[model samples]
Target: MAQVPLVVGLGVRNSIVSALLGKGSEKFNYLHRFLGRSIFVASTLHVAPYLHKYAIDDDFVAQLGKPVISTGCFGYIALILISLSSIPVIRRKAFQFFQISHWIGMVILLVSLSVHVPICLPFTLSSLSLYFLDLLLRLLFKTQNAFLGTPAVLLPLSDGLTTLLEIPSLTTGWRAGQHVYVRVFHPGMGLGKMWESHPFTIASAGAEGEGDGEPLRVFVKSVKRGWTERLFGFASDGEVGTGEDRMRFGGAKGGRRCRVLVEGPYGGTGNILFSSFSSVLLVSGGSGITFSLAQALSLQSKALLGLVRARSIDLVWIFQSEASLQAFMPYLLPLLNNASSNKTASSFKALKINLHIYITRPSSQFAYDPSLSTTLLPAHDHLYIHTGRPNLSDLVNAKVEEAAMEAKRLNGRGVNPCGLGIGACGPQGLVRSLRNVVGGLKGERMGEVGGVEVVTEAFGV
Candidate 1:
């Protein structure tokens, strides 16, 4: 019974210790997420034997008085909190709650398990050490402002749907697809105020900024009841309507800027896509584009500078409306203009970047019948928006097959097998779908499609 918890303890370490494991040496591939179910099973096995013994003995109530029993109870309680909070429905509905529960549960498990089981003392120490290391590193690399960290100015759009943030003093050493945790304290910091922080991907290409103290830009959606809502609530007081009536909010207009704390640029270091990959596919949905845009630009820069292994780049972006596209133009324009530039090496003369956009719910004028598959007016560069949700499975499956065939053709020339890297960040369902598709494609055709490498961007942590 005591040993069962050992597995649960090890699994917990694997899940959260990545923050301490530096990215340059140990890039957390998120391979340990499956440990959630294993930890739950181990927790059940560890507790069931004790519960069975308790049921047969009338002294079970008296046994609760024992310090060991009471201490063990906390470990059980933490397990329950983690198990229930990890449910997909609960996790998706209230991510912040799940995050808090998991954190508290981990602390309880560490402290209580150490008191209950002497052997667990080392495990607790190790986890705590890693936790402190992560915090210390965050502070070391954290951007510094005049007073606090960074002064992030939030500019809410006319529609009140999106906000463009201009953040000063962004931390250095951030990779293309890395994200930062932001804690927004409206009207600057104050005592007794509850702080809510969320992880948002750095949207702009050089969001780390160049030289001394350039500003980093990112887009935040004004989701209802989301942390962003409270951060932008100051601007919501004035008149609210679509069109130019409201214009953009923040900076000069109304003058609202919030002080924020930024932590980490976790997951992969430097280049997101492994430098060895020949072809790269970037998939994004809605704000997930924040993860893809910077990566795409980095790949372009590498290809243009004659330092890239990837020749073909396919970017698949899905959105709800054209307004969303226009709102993101600030980040996307640089990539497009650079890719379409006339100057560059002959080898860099052509970058095979095929951009595909899928719009789920467009304007009233656009025809969309749910009964039909899709109503797409596919064009060259500016493809017409699609009417329905994307069939992600079919799309990825086809790409895998196509990449495999191309790799086989290149193998005859005595060249090494071409590698395909597929990276996606989006809604949970979409990210899960991409992961499923990638998992299903693994070990196909004698491992021939050169090699298919997949990286999923998840905000679950």
Candidate 2:
């Protein structure tokens, strides 16, 4: 008999049930909330089993009078409030009021849960670690916002796509390919001041070494009736309007700064490239190439500074259309030119970096010469561009396998070297795909090769 998946066997059966029930349009957000509730219920059950085993014999009710137990009681109460308020019935009945209360209840739950955690030093240390991580990301975000000079700014990119943002700072340096969270306040929509935040990669770090102190640039494609359009198309200037206002005007007037909360320079592992890997293969979809570009530019910069040694770097950027490439050109051109010039000047084995642009959608304006070498010259670093979107799962898996094969090829000659580490920053689906591919490669070898390591950066939760 085939063994059941560990997730189902562990009693976390939601995934299995969802698959059996047909993962149709129940909405993922709702499913997420439901899963959270289920986790909370499971935690409650764990406590109950212990309570039942000890309560009768030890008089646990009397022990509950202790401060820790009292705090846990408050936590339980807060959880109830969170659960009840999160219910569709309550939310539908009084949407606005429920929304307001829900936030407050979540805050209370977080606080109570923190207190309910064990008072042991290890627990405290773990809590502190999370707190510091949040704090550091917040600080970096705030600094970026301030340097931008306005709390926020809304503008259009090359295409009709719009981006609404607030940056209190822009002077704190940001590497290329890093992303920031964008929050949109739309007036008179659904509920009031109900803002939605999402991550967008920095198109360019904004004219490196140029002392103008301008805001960092980001490229965003509007999707249906979402927060980006609401903020970019509606919000009034300087009015602190509701979601409705943002949906109408695209921006507020009178210098009312966008109030943005920034978080994270978090996940690009720069150390991977510094290792003894012979070559680097970077695969990205849509705006996901921003992180790869940043690494390439950083590597070029390091080469310029005579910092480290590397063989070559290859970049594969895949997007839906030529328009997407055009939108990214303002940022990408400079980096490419810089790398090209650096190659010309360096005799120290030029770090060959090749860029391949793959446009999935065919358009008259998007055609490229087929003769273009994906390789960076002098070192003959290979660059291969293929049109059409590669299945993300297949691409990740193939890359892992290829890296292992190459490692084995080198190892057969008695020159075993660490394989390239894959890094990606993208949407949930892509990140999840890459993560799975990485997990599968861990401890698996190709031929006589060493293993492959993958690094990823995911936004929000």
Q: Output the number of the TM-score-best candidate.
A: 1
- What is the Å distance of residue 369 in model 2 from its true position? 3.8
**Tens digit of lDDT per residue, candidate 2, span 7-28?**
1122221233333543211213
Q: Model 1 segments beyond 4 Å from truth? A: 1-57, 103-109, 117-120, 142-147, 187-194, 207-215, 235-255, 269-275, 342-352, 366-387, 390-417, 435-449, 459-461
> Candidate 1 residues 1-461, lDDT tens each?
33333334333323344445433212332333355566668778878888889988857788889989988888889978987997878987887788789789878877898899787787677667656655565567543432375776666654357666666555346667766667665543222223665667776555333333225666677667776665555544433334452333222133245666766555553443544676678899888887787777666655655666766677888988866755564455455556667245446554556666687878887663434532122123523346667788787777776676667667777677667888888787788888887787658642776767788775444
Considering every candidate listed, which one attains the maximal lDDT?
Answer: 1
- State model 1's lDDT: 0.63
* C-alpha lDDT values of all predictions: 0.63, 0.53
RMSD of each: 6.3, 11.3
> Ten consecutive residues with minimal summed lDDT in candidate 2?
1-10
